[model samples]
Target: MQPVRRSSRLTRNTISAPETAASSSRKNSRKSSQRRIRCTPPPEDSEPEVESLSEENSSEEEEDMHEEILPKETRYENSRTAFQGLYQEKPDLLRPSKKPLSARFLTQGARERTSTVADAGLLYTVCDSDSFQPSIVREFVANLGDAEPRGDGVAVYVRGSLIEFSPSLINTMYCIPHCEEDSSWMDEKLDKVCTLLSGNRIKRWEDMSSKYLTVTNQVLYKLVCSNWIPTMSYTAMNAERLRFIYMLHLRKGFNFGKVIYNQIMRMAENTETEKKRRIILPTLIQQVILIQRNVPPDNSDEAESDFPKLVVKDKKAGLGSGVDSKEPDLEEDIDQAISFLKGIRSRLKRGEYPIQRKNEDSESG
Candidate 1:
C-alpha cells in the first residue's frame, strides 16, 4: 500500500475553522442570550405559481429569440399593401365601366372601340362608334384592293381610295428640306397655299364631305388657271437639282458657277411670279375698295355734288406710279360692265335669254 491520492484542500483551516470561530466568540462574550421566533406565511400558496413564473420566463425568451430572425418578408408584405392602395387612388387609371362614345373626355378604354384605315396615298381616317360606322368603314376597305386587321380591330385598306391632297402637307409629316432656304419659291408656295382660291372649284366642292379636300382642290385649280405652269415647272426642275447645285459650289470650288447662276435666275423669276400672284391682286383689290368707299363729290350736278369721286389716293406716293395710274383704269372696268349689261338687255328684248324666256312663257300661259 501506497498512500491513497485525494483532492487537495486548504490545510490551514480545513479541520477546526468553524468550531474555533464559534468557541472563540463564546469565550469573549461569557454571557448567554435568549431569542424569540415569530411564525409567518410563505410567499406563494399554490404549486401553480412556480409553473406560471417558469412559463412566463420561457415565453419572454422565445419572443427575444424570434426577433433575431430576418425581417424582409414582413416588410415586403406591408409595402405591397401600401402600393396597392396608392394604385387605386391614381387619377389616370382606365375605368372599364365608362361609356365608349361620349366625346367630352377621351379615355384609353374608348380608344379600344375606335378603328382606323389608311387607304392609297397616305389617307387615314379615324372612325368611332358614334360617328364613322362599320358599314362605311367596310365600304372604304372594299374599295382598297386588300385589307388587314390590326390588333385594335382597325382595318387598313391599301390602294383602295385616293386622297386628293398629300397627308404630309396637312400635318407637316414630311417637310421640304429647303423649305426656308432663302428661296423665293418657298414664299410663293406659302402664298399659293394661303390666299389663292378657285371660284369654280369652290362652288363644285361646296357639297363635298371633306373640308380639306375642298380647300386643296380650290387652291390647285387657282394655281393652274393663273398660268402657274412656268413657276411650278421650275420648282419641279429645281427639286431634282438641289444635290447637283450643292456639289457645284462646295466640291468644284467655283465662285458664282453655272449652278449658282441658274439658281439666281430661278429665284428672280419665282419672286416676280410671287409678287404678281400674291401682292398685286390683293393690293389692287384693297385700293379699289378704299377708293370706292372714300369717293370725292362730283362737280356739276347738285345732287351728285354731295357724292364723292371714286378715286383712290395712294399713301405710298411716288413709289409705285405704274400701279397708281392703273388704279383709275380699274374704274373703266365698271363702264365695261355697264355695256355688258346693256348688251344683255338688248338680247333679252330679242328673246335671246333662252332659259328666262322659257320660264316666262311657261308662267304666262
Candidate 2:
C-alpha cells in the first residue's frame, strides 16, 4: 500500500511542473509585446519626420551653393563698372605715350588682313587731326539721348532736331559694311587668342605681355594697342580691347557697325553719369556732324600737304622721343597720327597692297 501511494504522488508532481512552465512562458510573451509597443513609433509619424529632415538638409545645401555663386557675379559686374568710370576720368590714359603710334609700321600683309574690319575707316580717319574735332565730339555726346533698348542705335539732338543714328545711318556715313552675325562667339575666341598669343593660359589682362609674342604678333599687338583699340595701359591690355584685336585678326564676320554705335552710346552714357564731358572716336562724331550740316570735308589736298612728316629718320630717335616726351596731349597725338596716315588712301587706291585670300582649308575644318 505505501509503494503505490508514492508512485501516484510522483506522477501528480510531474504534471504540475509542465502547467507552471506554460503559464510563465505566456507572461513573458505579454511583457515583450508591451515593451515593443513602447519602443517603436508608428510608420506614418516616423516616415514624415525623416522626410522633413532630409528636405531641410537639401535646402541648406542649395542655399550654400547659391551664396557661393552670387557674390562672384556681383563683384565682377561692379569691377567692370568701376573700370569704365576710371578710364572715363582720364581719357589720355588710353594712349601708350605722348608720341603717337604711326600706321607706317603696318605691313602690306597686315593691312590686307585687317581690311575686313568694318570700322577700319575710324582708325584711319581718326588719325587726321582736322577730322577729330573734340569740341564737336563733346557737343554731340552732351546732346545725346538715351540708347535704344536693342543696342543697335542712339539718338542725338543736332541743331534742335532729334536725329536717330541707326546702324544703317552709321553705315551710310562711314561706308562700313553691314554684318548680321552674332558677336557671342567672341567670348569663346578670347580664350583661344590668349593661348595663341601668350603660349600659355593667361587669365588676367595684366599678365599678357608683348614679350611672350613672336615678332609678327608683336607688330600686330602694337598696331592694335596704339590705334585699333587704344586702352588705359599698354602693359596691361583690357580684355575687351584684346577681344577686338582678335576679331580684327581673324577677319571674321561681326557687327562692327553696332559695336561702334554701342561704344559711342556708352561714352555718352558715361558722360551723363559722371557729369563730365569726354570724347572718343572724335572723327566718327565729326562725320556725323558734317552729314547733318550737309558739308563735305574741306581742303583735303591742302590739309594733306600741310601735314607734318612722320618719317622717323632714326628708329632709336623715335623710341627716345616717346620716352623723353612730357605727358601726351590728345591734340598733339592726333596731329602726329594724321601726318603719318597722309597719302595712305591714295596708296591703297593704287593697289599697292595685295588682296587677302581666304583660308579654304581652315574654313572647311
lDDT of 1: 0.34
What local distance difference test score does each model get?
Answer: 0.34, 0.56
Q: Which tens-of-lDDT digit does each residue in 1-365 have in candidate 1? A: 76544533455456668889989888756543443444666676655568889999999999999987659998899898887787789735544465655554466533421211011111111111021122322233233233243332223232233321111222222121212233332223321222112212222111211122222232222222221222323212232232222221122222212222233234434653465432111221122223223323334313311211122222332222121121124476679889999999999999877899999999999
Lowest lDDT 10-mer window, candidate 2?
A: 314-323
TM-score of each: 0.19, 0.43
Give the number of the best model, judged by lDDT. 2
Among all windows of ten consecutive residues in candidate 1, which has the lowest summed lDDT?
A: 120-129
Off by over 4 Å in 1: 1-156, 159-166, 169-328
- What does the lDDT read for residue 165 in candidate 2? 71
Clashing pairs in 2: none
Q: Using alpha carbons, what is the TM-score of model 2? A: 0.43
